[model samples]
Target: MFICPYCARNFYRAPKFRAVSHIRFLNASPNSPAIDVYLNDRLMFRNLLYKYFSDYVTIPSGTYHIKVFPSGNTVNPLIDKSLFIPPEKIFTLAAINEYPNMDLLSIEDVRHPKIPDKAFIRFGHLSPEAPTLNVVLPNGNTLFSNVSYKQITPYIPVDPGTYTIEARSSSSDERILYVPNIRLRGDRFYTIYAVGNLSKPPELQVLIPLDGNSYIGS
Candidate 1:
């Protein structure tokens, strides 16, 4: 068991965990309760979240491709099976629903370098029925002021580099949404679409190949 240095809480395992797939689902209403869960065409758990209306599945340690679909919703399933991974250690999966009041959408210009000659940023969300978009640069500066939106925006732009974007209710008191660890690169454009809610937090994914090769970063 390990204890959190900050929270002083004991954990059965350390933070350096491995391949165990954790799956979660929320708001299991009649239309979507105990939905069917799958890991790469294999049925691992069924109605996993039916009784408590919330479900979680822990798969054996390894890498896996995951797929999620509603019971008998073959015509129009909710989640498509994608990549699911379980490292050599243990990890917990927590699934929750989106706060209907807000949805977050943002993307950076992918083709251009981190900083382009001309940049355009795009952000979108659904909630507070029309709120202002607030963008803060890594330098602790404001690029765009409180710009109100008519509908969910498609995108916006900044000078370049890293930044944080948030949605504030018209009054700027309540935070509607937040997007962090957003790194704008000169290579490709990044776009995010949050439906109902985000399946997972925005991730800074790094793909490393198994082939024996050394990577030297700047």
Candidate 2:
């Protein structure tokens, strides 16, 4: 004769009630392989290890329905999750937030330049791996390559005066955007800005104003 819900035992000879656990990774799924432990839906423990499945459950104190799955893959099959066992307590779960590699390249604007232009060079990058965009010419000779995130260059023919344009980065956390030294007038009209590795760095703006003043016929 035996009964024990919480010390309601009529045990003629008692000694059998066990439940213990300890899981400390705190942030799972580095690349899941095996994890499944359930009870009351039946199928308790299958390939478990925070480091040794806690020696075969016996969690007695009331309240057990722990489920976790993702363990068997020829391709994929086995996925579920649940946990709550308070009796001789020892459970920890905290880990989820992974996905920040990086990719956001952009350089959109630079169409048909050939008319008194003094400054108009804009390029962008955040990630494309094999990336290179070097355009330097005060008269040292250098024009770059592997470029195609949205390439455009129509007025890089400087020789009217005032110039200092430099956009350089070959990859791995690259960012460039500088403006405030341009005056290579011929037909007149200018704009220069560079910034893109996700955002926030491209603001030297001036779509056409070397200070000649205009509302375009006003």
Candidate 3:
């Protein structure tokens, strides 16, 4: 049995003859127009909003052409790109806008067996206005440094406890964002996303959590 953290849906694997791949779509652009997604010129989703993501879709491993367009109009694609999917891997394709600029980011989601009495966590930098960031603990321990926009870190193990996670600019020690009182549980997996544009009103800076599903393992 496998579960998807994005939608909290469960799935059971069946026997297959060929390799397969899983991919999901995410809209990370704040205040941008809602969009549509297409693969191989076929519409896959419509009206996906900022900070919203879709469930994983499994397909045969191969190369694919992907396109994104504003909702209700397919004549002009905002992004067009080709991607290759290796067998038996999971990936997330994200659409991001830093106002006057729009781009796509592809992230591979990897999972492994949980260590006993410990939790695994990873971080993603999605804030466009922010510089490369350093993820630090309250004790000034750096977990990830020079993490740039659209970048994601590999999972790191830590003991289950309450923590205050902070992000600092790579060029300076000033804290850019701080998330306090995060409670992690043993044997669980989590991904923390740093989202929002620094220039936007309300500043769109936030830490979003996705509790990982343990049934999916490498």
Candidate 4:
């Protein structure tokens, strides 16, 4: 008795759920070990590496204890905390910083006020070594500025077309990444993540995209 907007398919039975929410995990720590995510003492995600983002998983809305441990080890947890999830919402949980100084940043993902014939996007700063950044368009307009590590911006709408996105250092105007010819389709949503460590051999930063429709019930 429900229709899937992404697939445009109708289902005879209502999707299983009473109160539900979606959650995605992002590993932003540059030097942290591969991690395992647990919900209520049960393993939920295994072997999530640095700079990786996991697809959204649906869960019933409630308060749950969350734990992050080194892969394959449960005796020691890098993070042990409890979080509350409200019904029919989306969230992104990011693990950040080096061990012993590690932390979690919980971001509420809001989808609303969409513009017709436009694409929506948000940017996340995950590169530990990178300085505060500025996201600029070819026309010299800035979309996001002074975004530091572990910072995430609110969604912005743009006309559906090809664009050359430039990431620059906010302090000195130094160019970091030039992502050219990126196309945004109408009515689509996206998250662009700045990834990589500045001290690493590949000094160049990388941008990774997570399509909005990756969540099943979104």
Best by lDDT: 3
Show where candidate 3 strays beyond 4 Å: 1-5, 10-15, 207-213
For all candidates in order, the CA lDDT equals 0.35, 0.33, 0.75, 0.73
For candidate 3, list the clashing residue pairs, or say none.
Answer: none
Full ranking by TM-score:
3, 4, 1, 2
Candidate 1 per-residue lDDT over residues 1-218, each given as its tens digit: 10101111222322345433333322212113455555567765455442121223344555455444555444344454444343432221212233221111212112222334433444323222334655454454654445554232334444556556554444554655565655554422333322222223322111111110010111
Better of 2 and 4 by lDDT: 4
lDDT of 4 at 33: 80
Q: Using Cα atoms with residue i matched to residue i, what is each candidate's TM-score against the true structure? A: 0.32, 0.17, 0.85, 0.81
Which tens-of-lDDT digit does each residue in 48-165 have in candidate 4? 8776667667778889899998999998688888999888787778887655466787877776655789888888887777899999987889999999988889888889887778
Model 1, 27: alpha-carbon shift in Å? Answer: 15
- lDDT at 16 for candidate 4? 71
Clashing pairs in 4: 1-12
Query: For residue 25, what is the lDDT in candidate 1?
Result: 29
Candidate 3 lDDT trough over 10 residues, lowest sum: 1-10
Question: Per-residue lDDT of 132-200 in model 3, one digit per residue for the tens?
Answer: 999999998998899988889998999999888888989987887888877778877777777786666
Ranking by lDDT: 3, 4, 1, 2
Error of 3 at 83 (Å): 0.8
